[model samples]
Target: MAISPQELSLHKLPPQNIDAEQAIIGGILIENDAIDKIVGILDQNGEDFYRDAHRKIYKAMLSLSNQNEPIDLVTLSSTLRSGGVLESVGGSSYLAALVESTPTAANIIYYANLVREKSLLRRLINSSTEVVTRCYAGGEKIENLLDDAEKIIFEVAQDKTKRSVYHIKDLIKHTFEAIEELSTREGHLTGVTTGFNRLDDLTSGLQPSDLIVIAGRPSMGKTALALNIAQNSAEAGFPVAIFSLEMSKEQLAQRLLASRAKVDLHRIRSGKLKNEDWPKLTTALGILYESPIFIDDTAAQSILEIKAKARRLTKQHNIKLIIVDYLQLVKGRHDADNREQEISDISRSLKAMAKEFNVPVIALAQLSRMPERRE
Candidate 1:
């Protein structure tokens, strides 16, 4: 009977111990096959050719040998094109030169890296056999085998040391510098400024990865305040992503345009848009669009989906700040008995995501219902 995921065995659990022998055997097979295929291609393609295409082919071969990525005609062509080699050459003549001149040891090294993806390696080897058979004749087998074995050992050792070293110190330092640079600018006009004018005077901008929570009762203009902050940040060349669960993108855009054009929000929402209002709305939208503000109006987005979308935005547009319309609208991953616990989890996750992405997260939250008093 098949075991369920929850009932899976812990005994002999670590795959490292169970698959050690199989891994070693697999590694040997991969290296041997790769060497044989590369040699065969070179043997079939006769020597004594010099061309730009040949140079591209050789460079691509060398890159694959070092990187241990699978080699195919398409990938090879793409790599050559990226390296400005394809533009220099007209055809596959340079590729022919590469197959003819690459050393047997280099071919073996390339195969040694293929141990992880045995099936894919096998397919690549089998597919290229025709080209291999044409270029290479059978060489001294034992000598090539020994060379491949040594190459695998050295490469594996180097990879282990490489994983142990961390080179992120410089990256962290540069990120600190960037945060400092941003902290010197004014953030949003109508938002809370930490209640200290001197500190706000020194550091005009809010630091990145900050979780600014705005709590207020109904009709407190919380959404308006948040939008103003987003607009200010976007206007300052800082990309902002707004997740509005309560409103549609068009509705939110309308509010921003009204704010920028100094028009009343109620007038725009009530569909009493005047003829003179057209120019202001259009001009405001044009300015906001060029300022790098992105809005997502998905109703009731889960925390996981929010995180995923935020990561994509950060990567694609280099988003510097994130704003969520209201915290209560967002649901957490778990189904909790109390609403408070769910809110807590959502808050924690949002804060964690801000730190992970190194961007500011401004979350708007609703206040609890006020107790009624006797008049």
Candidate 2:
């Protein structure tokens, strides 16, 4: 007899742990508290189970737990029935057999770990296979292909292959702890300080994950203001990252030195430093060199590139504040037809990047006048 496709698929099953799944289900049906134990250990959802029946049964168990109802065989079966899946989950007979076959609920955690391990392995294999297939196709850009492959492997290795839902109690506990810690700070600057006492007082310093937009007309000192804030934050011991799309790093350094030494910007640019001005410039340079301020003058950078660089800076230098000089110059990930839409996407990506790194991002923007009004 020739083997059918279904039979062939059955022969080549993905990594799984049916015995572990059964133990997990049996523990949940046997004891109401076992669900809590399994949830805590697995931190997973119904889809983590290998068997279809186990998945449905686990979903019912989660529903009961969420509803603050019991998780015994009867309540679970009732929930499954209400959801019109009791028969599909092998009825109550399979559930009963699961409970009888498993010796005890004490080892539910070990069994849950086994199931999670198998699930992770399966995800890795699938991701790797997809990456291999794409590599063989040879049509996409090499850079894009590498990025996709790295992202896939990183997701699996970082345990970010799936979205995680945190319990409310845990979130509340973290909030309370943060509140307590903030209360004990000396200057009452709960977040990273911007070094401006008045501004710090008004905003409680630069709060983490905040997107601060500074908009102004041309020659309005927007870059100057951003650079000042970056310097302040760095001096205050918070590492700062500056993405200068409008200025070169040398120009930025010159401006910083002139600003710190209270010298003329024009004189600094012209290299007309007096003999006495050398000491002041040297002092400013020494302080700035020691401070944790990083500058990247990548012109016309896309949002994705900015995010990638920011992530690297965060991991390498633990940057707490980011300053994008003149955000209007930054490019979007895609070339959209509408200019406003492109700018909107860029702004959204910057905000999202701030949250992802838990840093304060101060993006300077230009106030738009009509294009025809330009000199």
Candidate 3:
């Protein structure tokens, strides 16, 4: 294969620090206690290592630790030997060299961090390479390509984030602080207010990560209730996102206007405004225009589409609540075996979205008439 000098120069060494990798392993080999710190920093495994040999050695150490066995020269060598990769890893002599090369286990955290940083850069490079390749593929949709590009970059970026682990001491302090703050408020709720006194009191004002289902029969104002809640939440200074699969945005706005102004819904819909209703309508319209309530009326939306939009809203607008007009109207996988199964998938997805965004989700549902029929 012929290659240009420029191409060869461009392919310069990928981000890596062999010394750091060896130091981490050596530190862990000398002091097994250090592995605990490195384990959490690395990918919880040996995948963070650039060299195959180092990866394999770290993996063997993890295996020994899992079995409650000590990680020493003898156990590690035996474990590698038993796995038939002892010779491939430069034999037992190379393992000894790693331990001798490292100064002490005290700097294991710093060494591990160095290796982790290099690993992230390498991943970013690989992701960029893939994105470039996909961009030239020519047979894919632009949206798909862009999505793939963003996804690869996002994965590399997201890898650097550590899982949150809140200590009980901190949690208890936070809880006490919250209780004290709440006590000082005359009627303020801990969670976002839904405007209705009884419901707000009963549910603690639509708690975060909750999937609140409002169910009823046909023409029972399920959507009307959701829009009202959205209005209330927006009025309370909380951003609201409503996905009305069954109605248009204009229809939702009309309903909200009528409800807020204490005017007749039918009269507004019929465009028959009485002389006195015009003042109330204009006032309601002005207030509604300023609320941080966003509505999406794209009907027959799949769960994935809804999630993508909701994620965008949460990021761009800091949306606090998500309302799906009705659960049964949501589109799910076409390969689903039955309608019941499809609805089940949508239900679970909505719940997951709520938890993922740490926001409340209100999905309107319809009740079955079998009980009313006395079957």
Candidate 4:
């Protein structure tokens, strides 16, 4: 197929560094030890390479490495030929040139970083362009488009670098060091403190990447409990994020202030306070205002919307805990035909978000009313 001039110009090659890719490959071929360093730097697969030949060559190298085979020019050429891709990858001559191009393996990490950086840039450009095209098409609601655009951009920007396989020796060393650190701190929490001494002691605090669900019937103070934890975490200098699907931001603030000041919620809502209550109210407001807590009271927030906002908060504020006012109120990215399925999808996404951000997520849920009848 032939390409038109306009299309050719518009689709000009994506950001890439072919020389760096070749240098990385050459370095690995020269010294097997360099493979570990290159993998650490790139932390990606052969698909990250820009050129088809380079992709095939890297794939072959990875295969040999995984199989505990040698990765010299001779071995690489034989593997490529056996796979029927030697000619497609420019034959053994290209492999020889790659080795000749790299003088040493010491700088292999730098070369690999260049390749990875170019790949990330290419992803950013592609993602942004797609978002722009969607905006122009006007097929979806503006709000939905905005949510999708933000989701795509967030995924591209916050995508964690791929992890390379680690040797058991390295892992054991890390574990030994961690155990030593824990030994020195007797009775100290290993994770974020939840402000309840008994609960903290039982679970060693709200662990990172954990999804904690607080379930109860109506009038059980689920919101109050979540707010209390958020306040406590924030006061301890840990950043907190709250998604209030059931209440507005103002209402949540009032509740927090009431809890902190030990005042009746009705008095605060009705704006009727005694002379001494003013000082308590002022103190509560000051404390909460100074704490590193953020609230997003977006009613009926979709899982995608929450994830995007949570990622931004994680990047900007380094939040340690995320609280969802209630789980039943959150919407899923795709509306399921059944309500139960929708809730399930939302719950799964929340769990994924917690793991991705490496933060503890506390979600409030309503329990079945069947228990009431059992009594």
lDDT of 1 by residue, 1-375 (tens): 975332442332321121221232223233423422232222112121122344345445435532345565556667777877765764344433433444333334343233223333333333344334433555647566556555655654443332211111221233222111222234453332332456456555556677878889877889988888777766666778888889777677767778877777788889887888877766565565455677777666777557766776788888888899889999664447798898988898888878878887989999866543322
Q: Over 4 Å off in model 1, which ranges?
A: 1-203, 274-276, 372-375
Candidate-wise lDDT, in order: 0.57, 0.75, 0.78, 0.76
What stretches of model 3 exceed 4 Å from their correct place?
1-187
Instruction: List the lowest-lDDT window of 10 residues for candidate 1.
Output: 40-49
**lDDT per residue, candidate 3, 286-355, as tens digits?**
5666677777776677666577667767888898888998899888766689999989888888888889
- The TM-score of predicted model 2 comes to 0.50
Choose the strongest candidate by lDDT: 3
Provide the lowest-lDDT 10-residue window in model 2.
Answer: 175-184
Q: Mind sharing the TM-score for model 1?
A: 0.47
Candidate 4: tens digits of C-alpha lDDT, residues 298-354: 666666557666776788888899998789888653437898988887788788888
What is the overall TM-score of model 3 with all chains considered together? 0.51
**42-92: candidate 2 lDDT, tens digit per residue:** 533466777878887887776665445788878888888998999988888
TM, every model: 0.47, 0.50, 0.51, 0.51
Candidate 3 clash pair list:
none
RMSD of 2: 13.5
Q: Is candidate 2 or candidate 3 better by TM-score?
A: 3
